[model samples]
Target: MEPVSLIVLLAMGTLAGAINAAVGSGSLLTLPVLLALGIPPGVAVRTNTIGILFSTFGSVYGYRREIAEEKGNLGPLMAVTAVCATAGALLLLASPGAALDVIVPILIVFALVMVIFQKRITAAIRAGAERRAARRGGAGSPATDGTDPSAAVSPGDDLSSAASIASAPTPARSPYRSPALIGTMGAASIYGGYFTAAQGILYLGVLGTFTGRSMKAVNSVKNLMSLIVNLAAASVYLVAHFVLRVEIVWLATAAIAVGALVGGYFGAHLAKKMPEWLLRGIIVVVALFALVRQVL
Candidate 1:
C-alpha cells in the first residue's frame, strides 16, 4: 500500500460519501478507483458496501431530527428493505456481475429522468389533489383561485428552498404503505444490496417523484433507508468473509470507512442547505456522467 494509493482512497471515499448523501452514485466513483488499484471485483464491492455502512451512520445521525419525525413510517419500510437486501446479497454471491451490467445504467437513467421532471410531475400531482378538493366545493387550483399560495410551485421555485421551508407549512410525507412506493423501494434495495452503486439515485427517484417533500426532506429518508439496505448487505459480506474465507483489503476498507463517516455527516448538512434545483442539478450531472462512463 503506497502512500499515494492511501491518499487517493481516502480522498475518493470522502468525495463519494458526500456525493452519496447530497445526491447519489457516490459508490460509482469509488469502484473504478478500487479496481484500478488491483483489488479484485468481489473484494472491492464488498469493501465499498461495508464502508458505506459507516457513511449511512453519519448521515443518519446528521438527519436525526427529521428521521425522528418519520420514525413511525420507517419501521415497515426498514423491515421490507432489509429482507430484500438479504435476498439480493445471497443472489450476488450466486450470480455473476455481468447479469446486472446493463440494468445498472438503466437504473441511473431512470433516476435522472425522475429528477429532471420532478417539478412538472409534482405540479400534476398537486393539480389532481386540487381537482378532488374542488369537487367537494373546497378551494380549487392555486393558479385559478389564488387561495393557496403553497399549492403552486413556480418554475424557478425549489421545493427544498430555505425560504419555502420558512414561509410554507409543507411537511414531508412517506406514504410507506403505498404499494408503488414499496415496490420501487423493494426493487432498489435488492439492487442496492447486490451492486451497491447508484442505489441512492434509485432511492431519490422514488422519493423525489412520489414523496412530494423538499429535496432535503426526501434526502433524510433516503439516507436512513440506504443505511438499512447497506447494513443488511454488509452483514452478508461479513458472514462470507468469516465463514467462506472471502478476502477483504482491510487497509482500503479502513480508509474508506473513516473518510466516509466524516464526509457523510458534513454532506448531510450541505444537502440540507442546498436548494432543490442545485441538488437536482448535481444528481443529473453525476448520473449522466456515470451513465456515459458505464456505457462506454
Candidate 2:
C-alpha cells in the first residue's frame, strides 16, 4: 500500500474500530473506503474481514466483563451463529462476482432495518428484563444487556452483576431454543456474509428477543457474538482466497487488524459515553445515505 492509502486505511480503521466497538457498523466506513481505493469487491470484503476480526479483539477485550457474562448465555446462540455465519461465509466465497453486487443492496437494507429499530429493540429487552425481574422477584434478572435501562445500578456494576448471573446457571439447556433466535441468526449470517455494516444491530435485536438485560449488557453479548461470527467467517475467507489472492489478502488482513484495534478502543469509549439516541441517529442517517448510494 502506498503511504497515502496506508494513512487513509489507518484513519478509517481507527474510526471504524471505534464505531464497531461503540456502535457495531464500522464496516460501513472501512469497506467503502477499500472499494474507493480500487480494491476489487471480493478482495475488499476479504480485507475487511481481516481488519474487523483483528480490531474486534481489542473491542471485545475492552468489554471483557460483559463478554464473560454473555459467554455463559452464548452457548446455544454461538452454535447457531457459528453454523449460519460459516455457511454465509462459504456462500460468499463460492458466489460469483455479479451476485455480490445484487446482494450488497439487500444487505444494506437489512442493516438499515436493524439500525432503525435499535432503540426499540433495546427498550423491549429492558422491558422484558423488568418483567422477568418481577416474575423472579428481582432474583434472576440480568443486570446488563446492551444498554442498561435501570437507574439503580451503575453501568459498571450492572455489567459485573450480569456476568455473575451468566456464570451461575442452573439450566442445562442452551439459550438458542427460540425459533425467532434461529431465524435471526440465519439472517444475521447472511448480512455478515454480504456486508457487516450494522451487524451489531442485528445481534442486539436478536439478543433482545432472548434476554432482558440493559443495552450495555446486550452490547457486551453482541460484541462476543460478533467476534465468534466474524472469526468463523474470516477463517472461511482465508481458506477460500489463500491461493488466488495471497498478497492482497495478507496486506488487507494486516491493515484491518491494526485498524480494528484502534477503532475498538474508541468505539468502546463512545459506547459508554454516548447516548443510544445519538448512536441510533447516526445509524439511521448512515443507512439512508448508504441506501441512496445503492439505489442511485
Candidate 3:
C-alpha cells in the first residue's frame, strides 16, 4: 500500500474505534473509506470485521473495573450474544443487502425513540419489576439482583451522566430476565455481527430503559457485549476465509486494527472520566448521527 493510503486507513480506523467505544457508529467511519480506497466490497467487509477486535479489546481493557463488578450479570448475556452473533454472521452471505439497508435504519429510529423516552419507560419497568418481586416474595428487586445493593449505582445517573457509577453509592441492577432488555441486546448483537456501527446505541437504549443503571455502567456492559459479538462474528469470518475462500485484505486489516486499538482505549478512558451530562449528550448526538448516516 502507498504511504498516503496507509495513513488514511489508520486515521479512519482510530476515529471509528473511539466513536464505537464512546457511543457507536464507528464503522460508518471506516467502511466507506475502505471502499473509497478501491477495496473490494467483500474484502472490506471482512477486513473491517476482523479489525474491530483490536478496538474492542482496547475498550474492554479501559472498562475493566466496571466489568469486574458486573461480571455475575454478564455471563448469560454474553453467551446469548455470542450465539446470536454467530447466527448473524452465518446468515450474512445469504441475507439480502437491500433488506438490511431498509431494516437497520428503522431499528435505529426505535432505539433513538427508546433513549429519548428513557426516564418514563424505565420508571414503568422498575415499577413493574418491584411488583413482580413483591408477588414472588422478594426474591429479586430493583436494586438487588442477587448482588449487593450497596454496590449498585442509581438509575438517576443514567440521565444526569454522573461520574463513573463505580464511585456512586446508588442502588439498582440491570435485570437478567427482562425480555425486552435481553431481546434488544440479542438483536443488537446480531446486528453487531453483521456490522456494528450503531450497536452500542441500541444497547444503551435497551440497558438504559430497562435495567435502571447509570450510563457509564450500561456503557461498560455495552462495550463488553460489543466485544463478544465481534469476537464471535470474526471467528466465523476467519473460518470462511480459511475454508470457503472468502477474501480479506490483510494490509487494510492491519492498518485498521492498529488504529482501532489506540482509539478504543483512549475513547473509553475519556468516556469513563466524563460527567454524566456530557456522556448522555454524546450518546444522543452520536445516535442522531448514526440515524442520519443510515437514512442518507
The best candidate by TM-score is 2
For this target, which candidate reaches the highest lDDT against the unseen true structure? Answer: 1
User: What TM-score does candidate 2 get on C-alpha atoms?
Assistant: 0.72
Name the lDDT of candidate 3: 0.72
Winner of 1 and 2 under TM-score: 2
Against the reference, the lDDT scores of all candidates come to 0.74, 0.69, 0.72
RMSD of each: 11.0, 10.9, 11.3
Off by over 4 Å in 3: 96-174, 270-296
**Clashes by residue pair, model 3:** 25-197, 161-276, 162-276
- In model 1, where is the ten-residue run with the lowest total lDDT? 137-146
Distance from true location, Cα of 159 in model 1, Å:
43
Model 1 per-residue lDDT at 151: 50
lDDT by residue (tens digit), candidate 2, 1-296:
67777776776677677777766877766676666666666667778877787667887888887667546556766787788888877777777777766676576666666676767666776577568657776454455344444655666676878768656868655444566666777778666755667787667766666654445566776787778878888887777666656324566566767877877865568655778677666556654664565455
Model 3 lDDT per residue over 1-296, tens place: 78887787798788768867886656656665665565654566668888877888998898899889878776778888899999888877555656756655565465555545655665676678667656777555654557775445566556345455456787556585566677778887877777655566667656765676665558888888888888998899999889988778888889999999999997655544667465445445655664555555
Q: Which of candidates 1 and 3 is the stronger one according to lDDT?
A: 1
Off by over 4 Å in 2: 120-183, 243-249, 274-296
